[model samples]
Target: MAIFKHLRVSDGVAAQGDGKLPAGDPDPPPAADGAHGPPVTNEPGSTKAWTWRGDFGASLVVVLIAVPLSLGIAVASDAPLVAGLISAVVGGIVGGLIGGSAVQVSGPAAGLTVIVAGLVQTYGWAATCAIVAAAGVLQLVLGLSRVARAALAVSPAVIHGMLAGVGVVIALSQLHIVLGGTPQSSALDNLVELPGQLASNHTLTVATGLLTLAVLIAWPRLPQRVRVVPAPLAAIAAGTGVAAVLGWDVARVDLPSDPLAALAAPQWPDASWTSVAGAVIAVALVASVESLLCAVAMDRLHDGPRVNLDRELTGQGAANLTAGLLGGLPIAGVVVRSTANAKAGARSRRATVMHGVWVLVLALVAAPAIELIPLGALAALLVAIGVQMVNLSHLRGVHRHGELPVYLLTMAGVVALGLFEGVLIGLGCALLLTIRRLASIAVRVTPQHGGPVRVAVDGSLTFLSVPALLRALTAVPEKAVVDLSLNIDFMDHAGVTAIDDWRTGYERSGGTVRIDEVREHWYAPGRSGLPRPVRRTPPVRNRAAWHPLAATLSGRRQLEEGTEEYQSHVAPLVRPLFSELAHGQRPTHLFITCADSRLVPNMITSSGPGDLFTVRNVGNLVPRHGEADPNDSTIAAIEYALAVLPIKTITVCGHSACGAMDALLTPERAGNMPYLSGWLRHGSHSLDRLATRPDGPDRLDRLGRENVLQQLDNLRTHPAVAAREAAGELELCGGYFEIAEGRLHILSPAARVPV
Candidate 1:
């Protein structure tokens, strides 16, 4: 009745003829102390009491495993067994208290065993310890400065691959220890000895190791209650028990005389500075990798929260320093143990602290009993840990993705060289691949509907991307109006030149080229920072009333015929084209083209001087309205043709095989000629449009045609042209001058005009 709370207890008791009390309140009664149960702690999910109990239970489990493993790992590392135990205790106590994550358990790990052993042999234990302490200080500094995120910047593939390689090394190296055989001095030796050892070793020892591995692997699949028991612990206990009962002469820990005697505090010597410095560096690097990896893993496991990595590093550093002071080996956040604690229902850092307490109690009170644990069995446990870390499925996936070269190189490099060196090589390769990817990028060319051929460039277009762009542009028909818009997010010098050259060539062959809005200063102007304006002789007020002799004398060819020979020869030859203009006859259209020798607009247009008024430039560009300087002779000619010549239509023509267009199309050479590159970008739009078309002589023809249309559009922006066109006093047209065929193709009035 009391358990059910608010039940009719009095009535139930009366029915039973025994009255205890009446439960009248709806709420449950307070505990025996007349207070509500302890308020819930900040631990994740569980209530305070439940979380505390879980921590105690998980800690008990961790301690049972940490003690034996720590001692064995230290012995394997060639450091004093006490060092490992001290590290575990300090890592558990300090790291748990100060570190950012709640569930992480810190202890000496197998990954660092080789490094520790080597450093101890070379630097001596005291110096090694000092180095470890220095590393700790470094880590603390890094953590305090909040730069621990630097570790995350390392590529994920490289990090995982490195860890997998380490897993292999650990598994291979521990095989000898598990078989009651001493491993060789170096990893290479160990690798070479593997085949012989497998062949000659006692089948019984190998069988025992294999069985141990199988149990650890299978244990996780068992029921939840049984799964709570650490697999490594179970494997060790079973293997050791079997070895003992079978009377196998397997290698076992060589306990010190008075096992507790080795537990003295670590001593620092004046001469130990060198060793200490080395150890600290090694420890800092190893611990940082381990701790940060564990923190990231923990963040994933606990979907609700994440750890502050810098704070975590600081805590780990403090732990290592404490461990060194306590005669312990270096420690790091161990992923396996942290994961185990989480699965065991640990809700807070209290679990880590509790685990430390258990290590302390067992080390002080039951040191003798722990000595019975066999080293071979511990080796088996490590072999299992190493296997678990390999992530074979992920490796297989990497291989399937055709990244085997990178994967294998990383694996082989790490195994053959060392973790850091191998990873660096892999990183270098990855960087090369990245650069290749960037270099291979090409401009995106899209065809527009009933408009100029428009091409869009997304990534940076540089010299590296030129060939591809050229091929794309040349693919389009030269007759298409190329609304070549170099709306580029980024463009280098080479890209500018390629575009310019393409435009020049295209315009020379009679193409309409239009460049959309360009970034200001993308191109430079002439000496006056503006396009040179076209100049023309004052127009006759009344052509009909003008004298024939004066009109003939004022024509372009006549003006150039200052010499008597020019007057007597060239002027007479050109007299026919000028006679109509002299009599006040107006040409219907004007043609604009490049000044390249290959492109003679008059010859391509097949129009005599009076029939076709033309302006020529290296890159046939129409200066924006008002951007023309007074001295820009080309501009003056264009203005005169548009405003004073009584021309009804204007044609901006481009030609193929033009040098300036070629320059505009190639941007890589921009750095060498900064001003020219900047100037050439003005024609980039037409070049881009050309790039979208198919490559061929025909494509160049298309570019030339498109360039003409673009120029016509450019003319429409001119105030006089716009006003005249709007007033129906003038018309606009684009023409493609094909240099190869020695022909002109008119691209307006719904017909292609041939010359």
Candidate 2:
């Protein structure tokens, strides 16, 4: 006993907010930052020291991907190529300095291309720039009002469907450019003109576009070192290089002789006030939603400081204002470069800011080199990106939530009608679906040959379901006899009155009706002219009916009443589960525990039917192979369970203040009871093990834990248990239950106490 005196134990399970742990156990340790060291504090306004190496390297990786994408987006929007470059620089520098997100990169996004193209067509480029600036001002006001988070209340299905529709439109229009032809005004026109464009052979342009697509598809499968260069840059460069060397006649990028001379100031539109205001609001809301959603999405890619959405919205407004003033396209957070930034090991906002500086340098010095790229290659890149936006993963998620109809309707509306109208349609459909689900109810009737006919009602009962409920009640014939059970979870005033009126009429038609409410007493209160009960819990039963009192009733009478209660209230609810498991069982674990009146195996394990195979005996003992009585039942039960069932694990449980352990302490008390004394002999090894350790305050608790551990060892002495354990086909565990504390402590095999 002295060897075990210094052992320490910790709680495995205890009541929440109990303010207690094992006597000498230490508190759990804090989580570590990473395998390297503590996180670097280089966020936008942080005061701690900065780490430059990771951020500088990540910036170089992001800048290479941003330059070509900016040129392509501007081409697709029909804006001057320099406008795309201007927005990239402004978004990176200004957005990185003031935005709430630590690593999200901002630039012109593909999602805004449809709206921007329509605006430019109607108002001209200069007027479109003014509208963008106005939108920026509105965004700034909304951010200042601290209503940024409320924007996320819009349904995710609508947002995703809108993006998918935009992708479809972009792909249809850009496909014409890929075939060396001008795109038509709308998606439908582009689709209709596709065959005519395909008939006229533009061999060199088609060759370059196909080459670009091939390179983009095959780039990811290359070696890691080769993939360090992005797929977009490599694909475009491959197409451009082959078209240059072979003297192929393809459409090349056309930029102004001097890139700095392309900057232009925006002008006010000549349209009416209402038209201008509508365009401004559309740009503001779309940009705000896309950027905020992108910020939330990028947060999942890193363990950095969370995005401050309000600050992020304000920063996006500032960037757009600068872009619109300098003749750049509308700017928002971009997912492509942000993913690259995270994958490149960016630690802070420094990476985002530095990447913008690199793009500024590219626009200044590499204008001639960028002009060498073919327009066909850029068109091919946009086509691939547009097609990917209709993601299959998004479709599967919406289908699982039963929102696929809303999603499909929104997408169809956006493509056929317009973006705003499509979103309104989606909102209306979602409202209707919600109302339909809330008003659903079900009623079922069953007839017994000799007993009363059983009728059950489930779900919420409201005025919407009253008509349906009455129709179901008509299914019962004039009702010779009836047992009506109301298992409804909710009932309104109209519903209770309906049920009461039916019962009164049925009884008057020469029939007997007995009403039993399992969940609530809605009908009882309504018939008594009393107000409905505020609490949802069922009415409490009288304890005196089943309490073990000799003066009140005999033991047989109490047992019969308890059986009747179970049959009347619980049988119908559990009937389905019992019917499913009636034919066979495949329990995963075999539970062995004491046959104590207070220790319920199922309650302690929190397992339902067909989850555990249980064995119970006094002292919770298992006899060893060498030492066993002639008619041993515990050993035979173990053999049968291991041989017949698919049991993965076996558990031995012992409890505190156990009567068997107390009897072992004073064996003379059980000398007169032969059968009890013989059964207690199987726990002799536990007493020997306890004797070797020094006694402490909780001797009974320690002996009970030792008995659980000893029983696990005894189980291994069987040939089947030993062979299965050695082959890793089975596992053994020990648990000690403290009756007074109502806690179960898991025991470790290597130690004598619970761990």
Candidate 3:
């Protein structure tokens, strides 16, 4: 066993990953040699490892479970039982030796059962081996070109749909074998002949199949101690005993005790070259895709090492080639064994390799005992797995996300037609859904008070959206002026023609339509037949990027199609108020609050500029009446707003995440600046109020509410404020702003509630 380690060459030194270090986080720290993580060398017994004992134990458990699964998948795929054992050995040895992943197990996966069956039926068994070899070459080339990741670029819905389709096919065909009837050639044929198969099954064969199925389905619910034997093994063991006692005529796996003497040689294909070539490419693509996806899922198990997908692909290719040469079943990464390996505390790929070695040893040493597994028992195990593959929970999750249509369409196509056709239709559905989303439109018709009705359209407009847009436009009052605000990202000729035709008809009926394009020109208006050159809107310039007078004309076209109410209507209404207040201002209240942009004093108080005097600071804190500090910005504003203006009340407000309150709680923040730090000394009074509550994430908001009350008290300390309030001529109050709800909350002595 090798120690858990990794390396990367940066500068002159190799960066190393320590297994003990925290690496599970998405953002890991820079490596020791300061290079992005690179591959570590894999070796055996380089040193006494931390988890050698655990890895060894895990290997034993995995081999026991893998043996039954391998045999069952081979039976389902119609391959020779020895081919399953051969694939397992080659997968463990070749795949584990050179794979990029640390612990993902490669073996004869059930995912490829349908593909293998099709290949074997079309070509002879020996020629199918040749096709597997050809497919391995494709995988090797793909890995060498570092395009393994590209296999996962297809939509996950399509992949899952294809798998579910395969599952239904497996269950339908394998059911016939389980019931002691010969299976039909295809899923469609199986479905048509299923009723006849059910009517004419041997009584003893049905009993054996039912017993095997019951054991498999009930094994998970068994007591933990009794489950020490794996589910597949337990089910097969029970079926074998029952068949012997009843003297049932059931099919069983036939294998020679001397496995080496029974190995067959690969033969060249005698079928059409086109059909053979298609099978080879399909096998290669499907196998590579499944392996890569399994490796990615397994990566979350260990922080010890990240997988190199390209290298893992190369490893799988090598393993498959070796398996094919030996006339074995094709192999790919198996998630069940990989998950078991991870759970069993596998620290390295050594465990993965050892599991394969164990299977090889078992096949050669105990071939007679392995031959006792009943074919109906294996089919029973496969039936359970096939049902699981069409998981209803996963389908419900897909349905919740509006993807049921795609999944159902793919499944139906595959079950009724073929794999290639089903996948094409599924992919085609996904593409159409994507196109629909990209060409969707959102249109709103708002009737302005004593003004033209505003028809606002957002998102791209294509031919698909034209009919809906036309229907929506018909509701606008006849012979009325319409403000058409189009903020479209893209527009095609069909869309342009629809809108132009509608506008022409509307105008012909004495209705007026003004088209204002936002951001960029999507189409040329009034010149509908001509091809309009598309152009992108220029990026807005920042203050630093601005030239002399570009700001003056920027909003002219934008305001014509803008969402800002001030630019369209409010500014004109407020100009008269601004003119009257320009000479001098008289406000009734002096409002003090945080300088956060969202905390607008006028908006919160429902007051115009002339209605209230404003004072804004970091925390809305007020110092007690005493000697003035060097930082007097807030105090100066308060004094002027109180003495110079006709202010009748003083309102102090604080808000969530008040910078001053946070600074008060965390003292270290004050270390860098002496002036702002000293200025925040007024906020310390709010900390004294914190003893009322337990310390937690909500402490800042609690302290902020208290700070406002403290500031209100501080206002009373000022002689001018005290004298006016003493005479009952002025009012003082406190409040905090709730950012989430956009409501002002008053902090009363008894409780804080929204007003």
What lDDT score is found at residue 244 in candidate 3?
81
1-755 in candidate 2: lDDT tens per residue? 12211111100011001212112111123237432234435785332333366678889998988888888888888888888898899999988998898778888877788888888899899988888888888888888888999878888778778877777777778878888888988777888999998899577898898898788767766888998898889988999999999989888888787777888789989999998999898888888888888788777766657899999999988888888888888888887777677767776789999999999999999888999899999988887666666655577778888889888888888787877888788888878876675577777777755545667787788888888899999988785677677877777789988988898899999877777676776777877778767654524444463232424556675575457556756786789999999999888798899999778787777887888898899889999887887668887778778999898899999998899999998898898999999888889999998998899998988899889989998999988999999999999999988888767779987786777
Please name the candidate that would achieve the greatest TM-score relative to the true structure. 2
User: Against the hidden reference, what TM-scores do the models get?
Assistant: 0.57, 0.73, 0.64
TM-score of candidate 1 on Cα atoms, chains taken together: 0.57
In model 3, where do residues sit more than 4 Å from their true spots? 1-48, 224-229, 241-249, 448-619, 622-755
Q: How close is candidate 2 to the true structure, as a TM-score?
A: 0.73
- In order, the Cα lDDT scores of the candidates are 0.64, 0.79, 0.76
Per-residue lDDT of 1-755 in model 1, one digit per residue for the tens?
Answer: 01111111000001000111112112223345543334546766535666577778778877766776687677667787768777888888899999988677888876677667777777678756766676778889989999888877765556556665665666677788766577877667888998888777875666667667667656656787886566667776777678778887655665565545675454454555665565566568767876787677665544323687888899998987777655567788876567656656666788998898788777777767666667766666666555444554446666665555566677667778876677778788667765655566444454545444555444556667778778888865676556554434345567677777887788877776665322222222221256422321221123223323335344643343235224432575677767755777466677677777667665555566567676777667776566556676767887777667778767766766766666755567466987667556556567666776667755545555656655666667778888988999887766666666766666663333344
lDDT of 1 at 278: 52
Cα displacement (Å) at residue 532, model 1: 32
Candidate 3 lDDT tens digits, 1-755: 01101110000000011111112323223357653333233465322343565568778878877887788778878888888888888888899998989878888877788889877887878988898888888889899999989998987677667777887787787788888887888898998998988888866667777787788667766788997666666777889888887777767889876789877688879978898889888888878888887788778767667899999999988888888899888888876677667767787789899988899899988888777777887776677666656655457766877788788888788777878888889999999987887667888888755557778777778888887888889788889878787777778878888888899999999998887665457767424465544653332223223322225435653354343534443465578888988999888888898888768787777777788777887788788888457567778887787778888888888888777788898988878989779778887777887776678778888888878887888888899889999998899988888877778876785564435
Q: Which ranges in model 1 have alpha carbons more than 4 Å from their true place? A: 1-46, 68-72, 257-260, 264-279, 303-305, 393-407, 442-755
Ranking of models by lDDT: 2, 3, 1
